[model samples]
Target: MIIKRKVNKEVYMYSIGIDIGTTNCKLCVFELLSLKLIDSYSFATPKINSKYGYDFDIEALYSQLEQGLIQTINSLSYAEKVKNIVIASVGESGVLINQEGEVVGPCITWYDTRTQKNLADINQKFSDEELYSITGIPIHSNYSLTKILWIRENCNINLQQVKWLCIAEYIAYKLTNQKRAECSLASRTLAYDLKNHCWSEKIQSAFAINHLFADFTQSGKNIEVLTSTISTKLNCNQPIFVAIGGHDHMCGSIAAELKPGEILNSTGTTEGLLLLLEKVNFNKSFLTSQLSFGKYVKDDLYTLYASLPSAGYSIEWFKRTFSVTDENFDLLIESLLNKLDDINYIKNSLNIFIPHLRGSGPPKRNIDSKGLWYGLGENSTLADILLSIFQGLCFELKNTLITIEQLTVTHHPIIKVIGAAAKNPLWLQLKADILGREILSCNIKEAVCKGGVMLAGYENHYLDKNAHIQFDNPIARYIPNPKMTEYYHQIFADYYQPFFEFKTSLEFKLKKDN
Candidate 1:
């Protein structure tokens, strides 16, 4: 929904970056030489609520993507200079298509808990330890394996006859008629083997689902070109390499030049804490904590990732509940935060919110958990309620950050934040105080999409090795106030912990009863 035109007649080579996110699907054009964004377009991701859960409308999703792609290319001054198109998307959700180019099943959202029974059935056959060791993912309904199994059972489709492609790969297939899986996203599916970097024999032998998996490759590979018809439609004469961009968070990590000791706080619809590693290793703490280990977008590397199921998504829900549009979301939130400031909100909070509107993540990954709030006074104003919800989100993130530190065995000096949350000064300062850490928020917009652009340029050898360093991010640091940090620490330990534990117990009981 945003467009910016840059005219540079000297530029003859460009790269296209497509980011298929949970909330929005965006396309950006970057100069291959400088990686400067020239043009962009965005549209809402096509997902609708279903009886089973939220399912993506594959045709609608692809239609919007194609439209955005064509429009961006057509808007660029150097349309024929397009050299590479790279796709990055959220992990787990995917489409199943037949040999005749017909969609065979729904692309179920990863967070849908309808697959809980499917995962439980899987656990009876494979131990959690064995699954984690082979797949580097915990036995959770949020992973793709459970969703695929649920689809197989409900849709009653022949798994061998159709091909499975994660969201990004599906886009690649539609554009180039190529079916492949990137390493990082493939690892999100429990069917992938972490050690072998291919589809797992464990899943094949156990479930008899073999041909469903596509050919595997790393994120940086470009083995196909845009279809001739597509080329003509976009009025481009030059060949455009179609590169596979991996999971969105990992792509952001590449743009941020994230190192081993540092952490990337990627906050979008969902928020994740990612750490890079040179060696393939997992801790026993990961097994208990449910922290995910996966193949990095860059080959020969690994990632330790933990997530909060809802972050900005919660804010979006709040905005919708109040009928606030994007144009006014920030202004409204700032006004509310200021009102809170006048009342000494930090030292005296009457509400403790458990932000599980979607689900809970880490230490206890439960999709069945529901959102809950307590201590709302009869005199509570709208600002009080809003601030409570926001604080709950920060509290949940702080809990996961603490758990991630324990599993990784390092207390990072500063957290590098990417995505939309980094741009909101109110949220940044609040998070810094709650987490008791300095926040390094990247001001480079569309960082995830830029990562895709970087990969496309790097794959085509259009940029030098030091291009990541050249990103030259305008970082805004949020330092925690000493008194506020101390107060938050006490509240989290004394009040938030007990409230969260109680909600977990209550939600579990309600689920069991139903």
Candidate 2:
């Protein structure tokens, strides 16, 4: 993991990282020498509705990407000085493109529930353990395999005319006409063979999509030289290399300089805990707990992930429901903090929010699960509700961390907190108190995009692969309050654990009957 500085003739090099996120698309320009941000632009991703479920218009995404990238590049003093363009995108949302490189279908978003009906069939075809062994993914409809199956069953797609491409590959194809699937993103398809680093014949055959997938490419590998057409369209004259940057969380981990036994808690629209492993642990805890495995940016590495679909989403819901607008949101949370002088009183009166507004993730993987507020009363104030949401999210993350530790038999002493939620001091403190671990807040907000820039520099041979991967010193670190930590331990064991057990049991029974 040591990153040696490459003494290349190139003194100054710049790279553009286009982060194609679920909520918005961002293009970040970075100076490779200092890993400093040079420029950035963002645009909303268009969401569309299909007969079955929600989807992203691939053409629309590409259009916004082109606009944003061109604008960002134009702002640079030496526009043509940029050398690389790497893309990091949300996983599992893929589209079929025609031979002409035209999207034949919409990008079926991972959040869409249209594939729910196909889950039973998926489970019947492959046991949970069997699937996990092959692909490192538990049986779930959120993956591309189930979505592909759903499309085949519902849409009369002309299979022979199209090739499958995830959002990263699609963006790369648009730029350089190379259709190689980045390994990290490809692993999310549930048809990827993690051990072999290739598509799983068994999984593909099950869904009848044997020839649809693109050939695999190592993340950060230069797939193609930017096409002259794109260079002209972007008004850039430099020789630009187009590279695959992998899944967003994996990329974020790269920027975070995550190490073995360290967890990256990426908080965004959804929240996920990512851990890197040199070897796969197919223990019962992992298989039954619904932890997912995927390829890391490094070819020899793998990643384990568990997420709550509505962690941050639930907070947004509370804001809208309570009419907390963006301008006053921070003020309100600050006001709430001022009221909590007595930890004992706050903990005693606070409600427990089960943040599954969309659905639950891991262990249960229940789409039927709904958001719930427990221990609420007429005396409960806005402050209690706000704090409860943060508590609930941390509780979910703690449970996931516990499961990971049990499966791997390893303990992570500190959690690297990144993304939007990391900026909230109250939330960071709550996580440390609830999880009883040191919380290191990352100063860089665009960690995922920075990962793309890092990958590009590595690929272009300007970065030393032997030097230790170094991150900027953490902006701040929150230590757990001993009393609060001890109190939460008791609450977790006595209250949360029992409730989780009962809820999961009920969910399992319902799943069995259905």
Candidate 3:
């Protein structure tokens, strides 16, 4: 039998936020009166097992979401209080060919690397700066534009009868029957103009993409109300307001209270290091503002990001390859910690690692870049090698931070960190030491979901000092040691020089061969 909690009569209204991530989908309900977290639920993303390639099942995904939302509301004391539902989704991965108003194909994921050749061809035809100027996103195979191009070129599917949609937009359409793409997701498509805040006609002309793309809308704008069918499915008769929620990274940054001179570091399947700035234009020599989204306030403030493709993935790969004996994650973490403790000679070791196993991401999208382990000899053990890899990832993050600092002229001494990797004490300490910045670890690690909830709260008039959910003091702060910071700076300089050289050489050779 299912039990339902009793709710206080005073707090009768609530806000809901749904986050659709690469690995999971989560729902969070917050009291509209107090803006406090009331209930939450999560489900693994439904994937179709295939011999040829992996693909997400849209029907299964919607089913999971439907069930998860029902379960989430049922668990709450004031289930009927929920009046607003906002969704934040992983952008670039979601692609569908919509004919009139129906989905035609499985939503292709951003992780799928099947369009490498298409990406190469597109890049060759259009310069990187031109693409960035048009779409505010670097040319990459992970983008929906290239994936759509791939489908058009390879498949017998008719491209004339479809409207492309991002995952969030599709979910919104499913919820409200109104098709629109949020600015945050649209910016990642390599088809939206950052300055004009609309679909780029020049880009569409150059790529020969369909003009039936979904309309772009700003986040937090109420588009529609829930239908009787959706209300019945959730066992609620209350009106449900549908508001646009943008990219996951942008939402996560919002949760962290990201402002000028503040950085939000998200470490999940991949690490996304983002900065929220008031200005859009920056010097072209170093970092670029690849994407921007409307801020919650009236005046313009955009979330600019630089992402690393392999952060937590590096740790996952290491765990799978090295810690076969420990099936439980707690035990694996303990084993890793114990191994690190046992390494007495690591204090004086000069090992270095470069984690480019699946290739590096932004400022340079080097597909051929391979992971490297330098200064490895007979004395190196699995534990030592693991430490090197961990440090290597930190070094890459540090390099990115340095570049951002140089280009943007904004230095954030403290970084707000969220996601699964934030739980790793070793990694956090390493990041602090390498970047020479204080790392503020969030108590509630699910910043993306919380950000969405915050948006819902704002829409429902429930955000203030009295709100239970506040992004103030960090749960823990990792401060860098002066001596260690100095040591790392010297090592970082040496490591970065060879790294860029290697990337340049690889790109040159690939171009020559092609």
The candidate scoring highest on lDDT is: 1
Which stretches in model 1 have alpha-carbon errors above 4 Å?
A: 1-11, 336-343, 468-473, 512-514
RMSD of candidate 2 to true structure, Å: 4.1
TM-score of each: 0.94, 0.94, 0.88
lDDT of model 1, residue 413: 69
The residue ranges of model 3 lying beyond 4 angstroms of the native Cα positions read: 1-7, 48-54, 120-125, 208-210, 286-299, 323-344, 348-350, 375-382, 464-474, 495-500, 507-511
Q: Candidate 2's residue-wise lDDT over 1-514, tens digit each?
A: 1232233224557888888888888899888677778888888878888676789888888988888877887887666668888899999999888788877656789888888888877888888888889988887778887777777677778666678888988899989988888888888888889888889888778766778888878788778888999888888777888898989888887787787778899988889999888988776677778888888897488898887899778888889899988767788678766644467676677676778788888766677777666898888877778888888888888888887788777888889988877888888888998899999988675888998888777777867765555455556898988888888888888877787777768777886898
lDDT of 2: 0.82
Candidate 3, RMSD to the unseen true structure:
3.8
What is the overall TM-score of model 1 with all chains considered together? 0.94
Compared with the true structure, model 3 gives a TM-score of: 0.88
Itemize residue pairs with steric clashes in candidate 2: 2-466, 2-467, 3-466, 3-467, 3-468, 4-464, 4-466, 4-467, 6-464
Tell how far residue 255 is off in model 2, in angstroms: 0.8
- Which model is ahead, 1 or 3, in terms of lDDT? 1
Expressed as tens digits, the lDDT of each residue in 1-514 for candidate 3 is 1322333544477777788877788888766555556777888877775542456776788788888877887777666667778888887866565566666755677766677778777876788777765565667777778778877776555666777878877777788888887777877777877777778888777776656588866576667887778878888877788877788877776676666777889877778878765656623453243333322221256656777777777877887887745356555455555544333454555677777777776555565667777778888766666778778888878777776777666788898888876678777877887788999887564677777767655654556624445543358898987777777788878765586667658766887898
